[model samples]
Target: MPTSRELREVKAHFYSLAGFPNVIGCVDGTHIPIQSCGGDEAELFRNRKGYFSINVQVVCDANLLIRDIDARWHGSAHDSTVYHNSFLRARLDNNEIDGHLLGDSAYPCGRYMMTPILNTSTNAERLYNVAQIKTRNTIERTFGVWKRRFPCLSQKLRIKLEHTLAVIIATAVLHNIAIQQNDTVSIDNSPEEDIISAESNMQPLTSEGNHYRRLLLEQYFM
Candidate 1:
């Protein structure tokens, strides 16, 4: 997990990069395929893409370092569900994390997690979504670079689930190390497959959060 100072630094970098304010990180989940460890768990590990895997939720900073990651959930878990059950969620709600995280429509919009306007109800909202989508691409590119640097992440692992987790976490750590040391990093544009879960449309939006977004629309986006 990123420290408060690191998060604030990242948020400053993000503002400089894309003109989106107070963006500490980008939140997303990617599936990593694993060999079937048969049990009731076997079916649970199978995702909508029809494979046994783990859904790894990653929070990536602007520098492409993974600030935080959790690969404990089954691939069947929705992005929002995985997030809702995460320790990071508690941290976000508790203000342990200093700023908002950018996410796609698959995740909910709130005070600390900023997501796009789903239906584009207005010109301001549409513009906001455009800027939001652009800023949120940081996580997507992070995934691309991560999977490409550690090619094994892009492949189906033959190892057991425990080792699979170790491999994932280890590679992520190595990825961060490589970046901090200014190693020659190659980013592959090859797309990684991710399950796009539906957002909870009926869920009421937080008034403070909604007001915050509206301010962005009127001030920065308009």
Candidate 2:
């Protein structure tokens, strides 16, 4: 977990590089498949793709260094649901989070959360979505490199939930270390190499959020 001051630095760095104001990080979730436990808990760990797994949520900075990891949730949990109950939500609700975080359509649009407009009403809206998608690809490729480097993690993890959680967190720690050390790994540039997409059934967190989105469209996007 990054300190509030560290997050502010992250936000400033993103603004300087991408012209996106108040962006501390990008958020996403990837399902790590695991072997069946053969109990009622088995169903809870089964994802929509018909596999038992852990829904691993991650927050990453622009340089693809993970800022946080939440692997405690079951695979059946929705990405939005996992995020809503997180420390991030509590911080945002209290205005402790100084800047917003970028996410895909799977996450709801909130005061400190930005998502692309579901339906474009103008060319500016279209362009805004394009840029948002392009900038948010950091999380996607981060997960890609994490899983591809440790192929066993991408496959059915033959371990219990507690052990699985430890493994996931350790891998994330190693990932950040690798990034800091400038470690190199072969990347699969094919779009198909990305993790499975979320079911993007999104809505704004509050009426105020809708108003903010409109202001963004009118000011920066226009």
Candidate 3:
């Protein structure tokens, strides 16, 4: 979670990219492959892509700095489920944060969590989607850079699940340090799969969220 001052800075950075206002960060889930900890509960780690992994929920600013992360969920868990059960969600629900997060359609829209509109019948809505997506892409880029810097995240972690979780956090911390130090790594041409997918059992959008999104569109995009 960002401080009030940091939130303002992040919002300005996001708005500069695509004119998306009041966006504090971009949120998304990325799967980290892991070796099976064979047991009756081992099947719980198998994801939709038929791989054993952990579903890590991350929130990053426009500078590609990770602000928050939840790497406790198994790969089988849906992105929405991970978010709903996250401490960040509770903070947003309690109005602890200052700005909204731009997530994909997989996340439920709320006063603090803005998701893309499914049906856009107007130019304003379309523009809103474009701006939102452009600003939201920072998380994807952050994931790409983080994984490229530490190949262990892209490849299967051969350690125990407990240790794997610690390793994930450690790498994320080191990644942030690199970003702070202005360290650059050449991104190769390796194909990074799109991890953002629709949830079959989606969470219902809140009325407040719908109103907030509409206000943003009419105020800035229209």
Per-residue lDDT tens digits of candidate 1, residues 40-84? 768988888798889999999888899889999987888888899
Which one wins by lDDT: 2 or 3? Answer: 3
lDDT of 3 by residue, 107-161 (tens): 8898888888877999999999999887888888889999989998989999988
**All candidates' TM-scores?**
0.90, 0.90, 0.95
In model 1, the worst 10-residue window by lDDT is 195-204
lDDT of 2 by residue, 46-103 (tens): 8877788888889998788888888988888888888988887787788876777889
TM match of model 2 to true structure: 0.90
Error of 3 at 178 (Å): 0.3
Evaluate residue 190 in candidate 3 and report its C-alpha lDDT on the 0 to 100 scale. 42
